[model samples]
Target chain A: MDQRPPDHITAAPSLAAKPPIVTLDGVSKAYANGTVALRDVNLSIGRAQFVSLLGPSGCGKSTLLRLIAGLGDLTGGRIDWPGSAKASDGTPKRDLGFVFQEPTLMPWANVFDNVYLPLKLGRLSRKQARPRIMDALAMVGLEKFERSYPRELSGGMKMRVSIARALITRPSVLLMDEPFAALDEITRFRLNDDLLRLWAGRDWTVIFVTHSVYESVYLSNRIVVMGARPGRITADLAIDAPYPRSEAFRMIPAYNEYCRMVSAELHATMGEASPE
Target chain B: MSTSAEPVAQRADRRLIALRIALPILVGVVFLGTWQILVTWLQVPKFVLPAPSLIATAFVDDFASLMGSLWFTLTVTVEAFILAVVGGVALAVLFSQSEIVATALFPYAVILQVTPVVSIAPLIIIWVGYDNVRVALLILAWIVAFFPVLSNTTLGLRSTDHNLRNLMQLYGASRWRILTEVQFPSALPYLLAGMKISGGLSLIGAVVAEFVAGSGASTGLAWRIIEAGNRLDIPRMFAALALLSVLGIAIFGVLSAFEYLMLRHWHESAVRREN
Candidate 1:
């Protein structure tokens, strides 16, 4: 009761107030099969903001995330990394992290080796990258399991290793596509908390894709609810929840309110998607 | 109940292990015993159907020459196996790198694999010449052993997890790094499996090639079997055949052990699962 919420913990600041790190202008993606995955997705992500692309399965949230990561080419549009110090060939920023729906750890490699991948690709010697790799693993509390292979770890542990691997590069942007969807409830809740802690302690921009309204409500400062059948942004709601959010936050009325708002928007989108 | 059942489970495990060893030996004994008994009871001629005891005696009697021939066959088999593995894996890596090259070369590999070694042995001997008959045999063995490694490894390399491939791409991994770090490790189990099949095939190829070469060239175990047959030394022929079978088993066992050593840590196929 003595603690106060942070001043910035209000609605997402307007574009004018916050400096944009990346801008997606008229971004449209059409598959070779004539499927319009995303259409004219005009959005600007501010630096270090926790943004969630919340939608149903077919809403192309994952597609949008992939676009940002430069894993696939956009049919028509441009992504600009404004004020980026690094090279811009319209490829994924070299220092960005990506976590797929699966843990995506190499089955052959132990946790340490898996975490070392990005650094290894960066041409850092194993000995040189060892300290940073250890630090990243320690961040995810997987320091002890460094020698354990992916098959030996539990589902949640594998995901943690994945997160650790992503963080190893100290990436400015972390793009995750339904990373916790495969996990059980308890593990998912714990990971959500852990992810928030990591995010709070760092200045990393996160673009998380998920269909879960509750998850979107709990983690994100701004939730961009997307609609299918063309796949365009339907609503952008900001949850003004304070951080250092604990298990107690789930009990608060505001949390439920945010969840309800997201769910309603999602339901409306789904309704519009299907007609009798 | 859990505490009490623990000992029972341990006992059952021990019993299972014992059975695993015992059952195979028991089957072998019964099989040999029936063969010995039937040969004795029917008063069968040794040339037509040698008894187990006669075969054992003949094996010892012809041990020196048989051992030499066995060594010759083994050397050829091992050399051919090594060549197959090297050639197959190299070609597979090349195929994985270029779709056009793979499209051009893959059909010939398939053709080589589908063609029986028996049919090819005579032509190989003629082309390779009697002076280099062993080289002809080696070539034939290599042909038999190469295809599985190529096909399996190609499938495995191509089957690198899409997500992992995307992850590597996200990291801006070089194609070489992607191959060494991701594709190679993924293909290892498949390559090992192919090697296991190739091990047995290599031995068979060596034996078949030697059989076709017949009488004149290097006297391998297959040639010894042919010689024994011509002279009505049926027991010696049986002994040589037994040695060939043992060599095949030994090759398979060695390859399987290699596979286990390589993959036991990570691969689901090699990892121990709890029931």
Candidate 2:
């Protein structure tokens, strides 16, 4: 609440002006073995913001994403879904969809069935959910391969199926944990475009976890850079670069400038706590 | 040249299929011919070693009784196999319900698996009442067949992908929904493998239990084999033994076909790679 947030919560001056959808107050997670995965992570994300939690390995970016999605319990502090978007459970995290590092698909099921799972679990009938499933798959460009099994699909295709599945419920928030890390560069770039295209003009919030700073700068409007060794946010950046960013943007000077700024902020934080 | 090339490829494909079928039959024919010639030339006694020709005659001669015995054996085997499939899968589902339950019950299944069926056949017959000998045969066969299904299915259920389970959890799926939608389908390949193994064990159980239970209470192929051996009717024994082999192979074939059909879409073992 200070006029200037303590040095750790640097950046995000523009974020503080917008109404926050989610607020984390002194959130901390510690395992039973006495390892503090995250410590006192104070942050707020506005509605429809594509916020990237970017850090190197062991930075607790993944843990932070999991906690926000309600997949894991935080040992201390709390997270609040402050917007009117509190899904029926009084927390949007329960209703938020997730895309893991792996496609994490049920191999036995076809593309249609895989995409249909969350709806099916919610007790929606196949006939009723067919249109939504098809729409989700088509949005990811996989409608024609609805009958294809996960085994038959390539790595990028599998990730697309995973994206389709995550969006099938039309969740207000989607959490992606390094979803495109395993993909080839060409495939990753295409998927990044496809993902941006999907998130554009939508009201959904996406919290993406990534180790790559360029990925963070390219994909997210707001980047919350964190550091390892009792993980906490070191900087919160708002990439002011305009949308409809394409291959041309990657070659532009402004994009490079933003990446360099995020990169320096990231390295500065990593240098302080990192053992190496 | 392209038109001719297609026909050439089709003809070669047909020849490959023909060879697969013909090769095994060729080996069987050669072995049987050698046996027949040796038996006839050496003037071997039919009581000591029945030639393939003599076995054939006995097959024709006792065709009526053999048919009856075959039907009875097949009936018991099928009944036991069906019971094993249902009971094993059901128990596996129950075991998968709780880790404590699986731990508590798994040892008994292992005991049944390890303790030879032959050792327990007489006891099962006695316990079920000697008059309920057919029921005894069914239970013994079921025990042998059920273990694989129960063990394999539980393994499959346990090995459901961790991330997928987490995904289901995130979606607010209930225990039942997770089991039916994710757990069961994931365990299917393992379940099918168990069924194939159990199918053969069912027949073995029926025959072995009958052998121990003695020939009096039933008229299955096992009873036929014992009766022929006691009378030194070796040709009839060979005929019964042949039926048993054929029956075992048939059950394996059916189960394998079912497995392929179920898993060809996704399972690595069942899919045709070249295609």
Candidate 3:
């Protein structure tokens, strides 16, 4: 339990200390059926920052994450990856990892092979990629389950494998879409702690999507609360909680205050969408 | 008490295994015995329904020539099965790559599947020439066997987990890598299922084609059965039929074993669940 607040929040002279790694300018997504999923969204993600897109379902939090990952074609506006633009051939820069809402493990493959997937796609031989694959499985604390298939694992373990696979590429940015939303509370808490530790150990940025106010407050250095009915960002609040935030931090008054603030902003957005 | 219970459980397991083998064998023995006794008591003519004993003696008496014909049929069935698998999988992969190609070609594949091979066997025989009748039979059998592979594999390829596809896209995975590592492995159970159905269908196609061809000395087990029928050698016909049934069972057994071996560790259908 490292009781230190995130170094980026407390240590920086200004909030904009680091240059933006990714910039989403006036982004909008409207399906062909005339449903507006997102509208005029503007956000900048700084290097190594843990940002949570916190909102109710249909607030396009997941959609926003997908747009950042280049999974979907944005209906409007531009997404710029300043560092990744150097290798520009118009393909979304391959320097980002995405973890879906589901564990999404290839049910046919074992943990080792699943984690080795990105490397295999890159044409790295098994002999060349073995160490990195083992390292990733070890990072997720699944080294002993290397040969175990996804079907044999518990829900928490599967999500851990998904995280390991996502981290294997060692991307500059990691985009997660409500990962661990399916897990039980105890498992979720354990994962939240583990995620923070991993964040502290690395220099990569994380853009996490979640509907849980407590989760957003606990994990993120910055929480961007979103609203539905033509999805848009309703509030941008910083959780100045120190890391490594442990089980003890969850009991503190400041943690409750941050949760309340996020919850109030979300309630305000939801109320605005439906008058009744 | 716990130690005593362990051996009791082990004994039960051993008995279950024994029953699994013994039950089917016992039923088969009872069936043969009843048929033999009934036929002998009634003084039934062999032409109508040969007794199990007569069929067995016929099987031994004509063993050499019957085996030669069995070998011929097996070769054709095996060849047709191989071609069906290869062609079906190749086409499925092609379909997976291009929607336009699939749309253009898939209906024709369905048409081929629906049309009876027996009706087309004569045309194939004519086109391929009497000397290459085996090739004609092979083509007809392939037609019967290839569709399940194509349709099932295409479904499997298309049904790849969307999240996994998105993850692959996030990594900028090449088309080939995605196909081999993701789509192909996902399609394994479906492909094996198609193979099993096609295995049986291929045998039927070969036999049907041989029946239609009616080439006397040069043909397969089906031709032997046809010749025996013309001669009213019902016992020999029953013997040939028995051989064909055995071949079908053997084909099914081999395919099932393969499916189990491939999917035992991961697939839901193959892995045993305690609950």
Query: Which candidate number has the best DockQ?
Result: 1
The backbone clash count of each candidate, in order, is 0, 0, 3
Q: In model 1, what is the error at residue A44, expressed in angstroms?
A: 0.8
Candidates' chain A TM-scores = 0.91, 0.92, 0.92
TM-score of 2: 0.93
Q: Can you write out model 3's per-residue Cα lDDT over B64-123, one digit (the tens) per residue?
A: 989999999999999999999999999999999999999999999999999988899899
Better of 1 and 2 by DockQ: 1
Candidate 1 residues B41-127, lDDT tens each? 999999999999999999999899999999999999999999999999999999999999999999999999999999999998999
Sorting all predicted structures by TM-score, with the top scorer first, yields 3, 2, 1
Which ten contiguous residues of candidate 1 chain A have the minimum total lDDT? A1-10
DockQ (C-alpha) of model 2? 0.82
| lDDT tens digits by residue: candidate 1, A200-227 | 9777789999988888888988889899
Q: Candidate 3: how close is chain B to the reference, as a TM-score?
A: 0.95
Comparison by lDDT, 2 against 3, better one: 2
Best by TM-score: 3
Give me the displacement of residue B65 in model 2, in angstroms: 1.3
Ranking by lDDT: 2, 1, 3
Interface C-alpha RMSD per candidate, 1 decimal: 0.7, 0.8, 0.9
Give the alpha-carbon lDDT of every model: 0.89, 0.90, 0.88
